[model samples]
Target: MRDQEPAPFDAERRLSTREAAELLGVKPETVYAYVSRGQLTSRRVSGGRGSTFDAGEVEALARRNRRDGSGGSGGGNAGGELSVRTRLTLIESDRYFFRGVDAVDLATRHTYEEVAEWLWTGRMVPGITFTAPPGSVSVARRAVEALPEHTAPADLLRVATVAAATADPLRFDLSEDAVLGTARTLIPTLVAALPPRGHDRRDEGPLAHRLWPRLSMRKDPDEASLRALDAALALLVDHDLAASTLAVRVAASARAHPYAAVSAGLGVIEGPLHGAASGLAHRLLQDVLEQGDAAPVIADELRAGRRVPGLGHRLYPGEDPRARALFALLERIPRAESALLAARDIVETTARHAPLHANVDLALAVLTVSCGMAPTAGETIFAVARTAGWIAHALEEYGERPLRMRPSGLYAGPRPPQPLPE
Candidate 1:
């Protein structure tokens, strides 16, 4: 037979959650988490209280978990699933902690830079501000400017990171102090490199304020909006061992410089499954607003065999904690009221079919849509905020033994000793 696309995984066979979870060697909660994250889908039979999983999907996920025994397969393995432990962040039920502290509390009470410093060093640096060197800014901005004008926000940040790495002679230093310095400067440089909206604005105040002009053209943004942006950054600073973070750890394990480690992460996040999810949610909300009803918009999406984005998450079976926290803050913004209502409409409308809860992407969509930002703005915010997390993971990986993330591939192809093709 000619080479063909792998068939879409469907329920040729269905297994109860217990069977599926046992097949994957995980607890029932983990199976639910897998379902929530889109790693597997849960199907409920008529007159049944519990949901069953497609046997094919369950086996595929099992293969993924076993391949090199890492959470994100084919990237590299730090350890088996739940074995990539770190003191950086922990996700429990629907809540997450950073260094043993409630992340939502920290983000709401402190600035993004403060929470980031805490994540990096476990110390609170009150009123810390990251200022990129003029030389680095010049180099990064020039490199970013050279890209095609329609270049994506994440791609722009990646190019800027490479250029900034070139500007710093000590990029390969790998010492804690040097990496911390690079992190402080590199993050600001990433933000500054983007061509500013309205006019070229000088860096000032918190990192969120500096990032605002790059994502939004509105001048003199309000205090509340800036807080929302800052809170979003802090909340998104790190999620333990996400695919991009794993890519970063793998890079750092290989002794790639911090810039390069973050670059590796950026490369992984440009995919629709990760960082671009927020953008998808943004466009979804926009569609709902334009149509004046979420049912029809979501119906169109479902009819076309598309998922309603920003609806579910892997770690949170209930509403995402970040989404809950962001929604609370968003409720205070008068302008966000309409978008928030629309988001609620979307969730309620979709719940008529699937019981998925709102995720951080939906909350981010509300923020971007209400703030007069572009569809790409949510992903931009995510990229800038997540750079801190990539660096944090990089720092953690640097403390480990060198080249620890080696993958053991399971060859499914024809045996290598087979004769060469005629």
Candidate 2:
């Protein structure tokens, strides 16, 4: 049996570094460099025999290098996921941080304004305030009111964002100072533009207080409820590279105006699988509230091959810290005990059946229920709070390579004829 031509670069086989280097006409060290730069992915051999690369990916990189004239050296991988660096937020050890401050601590101690400042400017500037100009508020309000009667609150927010942008003649300023200034006013403006809940009070507290009447049915929400809403906003200020954050960054990377970036974020967040998860969790909590038993509900959700909304986060191995913090605060509220108990029941039931733990969505859901807010209140809260994060991300992305998020497709269609007759 002749030594049949050593199986020419088997695309199905995972290649060793040396094998990949040989096929790509590069050194083994260069192969390792590609892995480090995220141009290629590597996995350890089962028995710890160094590392291996995906053969198809390696070939793709080689072809891309040849076409681009860069020889697989710099820039992002052609057919690989891009991992952009950001200093805004970090998720480590199941805890989220903005800059260096823990989010849970911020939720408890700092106001939403302070947290937003930290995320926006990397400094915890105290006494910073955000107030939408009365004229801008009027414009946004008119935009919000013009929507169809059944428009969701989140959609109203999106329209308000665009309206505010249109009203501000200076919205094109991309400088950090200008963007931060716009955001400071933009958030409060959006809050004020929400359909008023008919609660007119002289004492205007934090943004949460200003926002409470809009989110809840109560004419005057208690201090504890206001605090919970504030914490929800602060806790959601920023999370590293969420889908919506990525959308904001992508828009910013293309030099879209700040409002456009924010609108992109809102649009992505409107998806049921993202920021709207809390609304589903709200419904689930409603069931728990009415039935007073979570075991059967949990069983039904799992039986239908459905995940319990607001339970389990891929990033947090243990309980979500934000959920824990909010639950603690909610448990302290006088009338929130029943909602808290329902939350606990759902959590316990979820844990026994699966490793699913309560996440931020559940926290928001229970908080809304406790405070007697509407079913869509959690989503409204998420969208508004997450605006701060989206702005922060937009600012960050503005400083990076423009339009770096453009992706390539791996064509899997049938090949065309090489030479067609005219």
Candidate 3:
């Protein structure tokens, strides 16, 4: 008998069109279009006429397209745009959705500690606990103690981070888990060190609950109010590689330690063009309330060619998701009738005058005032909440290979030959 024919190798084991599209981060239609255009080659099965492309071929096409600035993982290149690269940790999707649940929903149903835990570690359960590495606790404690008496909690945190970084032997460790653990411990410790502002210290719960005494004039926030604030922080915690996050990663790219990286981020955030807009928005609302109408005020400002702050963003075309969420929470407050009216009038007036829509800064400003926090503390609160994201980005940057960020510039100056009179 003739030897049995050797079993034929299976070629269809390679990626299907759908799998190829998923791996390339493009739509299936795009993959099919590529095959149709001969940009990628496909083979038909012996019995069936349908085509299947080799996975290696698809990957090679992606690499070649990326090199030629044609197309790659993300999408089409009709605009001839190079894909913007970033080494920062992105929380857009994962932080937005956890355990198949929305972060906004979890924020409403859970405490700030639980949310922090979920962000720092990927778990939704309560067994996770934060502890500073052996010597880190002592260093952090000493740093906190060394802060000038009566310093605001947020400022104290700034000072303590610098000191803790100086004290830590492992401060150079840029591992994700290490940095997140450090943040978990650092945030709670800094909160605990804040000077008592009022009489709310008797409340029992997480550091955020205890922090109320140091940040609010009200001795006790009603349960509803506390929940709202908690949700607000959760919503504001992170966005994808924001400007401040970019600053942190840039600093880390220079090999700065975590504290220095965060400090750089804070400096960027303190600018009026960034985090301070929220405080400005609150003041603007106050002015509108005092003046009894916003339409004329807004019209006058626009007529004078002055732009109102906290009304717009480069992202979020429709309206800010965080702003909408916070506004919904603010509407629940019992005595916010005047503020609500002012907010409505401002929104209408602003829309009529410009394309800008209300962003999170505007809503956060209103909420800060409603919470009885001092006007200056509004920006400080934003810094505190965003530090988690900054540190995460810094750590991610530290792990990536360093690349100098210098860009070429045009020589616009005229050549100088003759010397000026001495």
lDDT tens digits, residue span 29-117, model 1 = 77887877888899887897899888888888878777747443223246345356588999997899999999999999999999999
Score every model by TM-score: 0.82, 0.81, 0.69
The residue-by-residue lDDT of candidate 3 on 247-352, one tens digit each, is: 7777887888777888777767766777777777888787888899997778766788877866877655667767777788788886555676787788888777
Task: lDDT for model 1, please.
Answer: 0.89
- Candidate ranking under lDDT, highest first, comes to 1, 2, 3
lDDT of 2 by residue, 1-422 (tens): 87767756667789888888765655577788888889999999998879999999999887876555344232243344345577888899999888888889977898999899888887877867787888898899899989997798778999999999989999999998899888989999888888865655322558888888787777766778788888889998888888998888889989998899999989888777888899989999999889989988878888999888988888899999989998888876898888888988998887775777899899899898888788888889888999999998888877765665554455668688657768
Q: Report the Cα lDDT for candidate 2.
A: 0.83
Q: lDDT per prediction?
A: 0.89, 0.83, 0.66
| Lowest lDDT block of 10, candidate 2 | 69-78
- Model with the higher TM-score, candidate 2 or 3: 2
Model 1 ranges with Cα > 4 A deviation: 1-82
Clashing pairs in 2: none
In model 2, the runs with Cα more than 4 Å from the true position are 1-81, 201-204, 417-422
Better of 1 and 3 by lDDT: 1
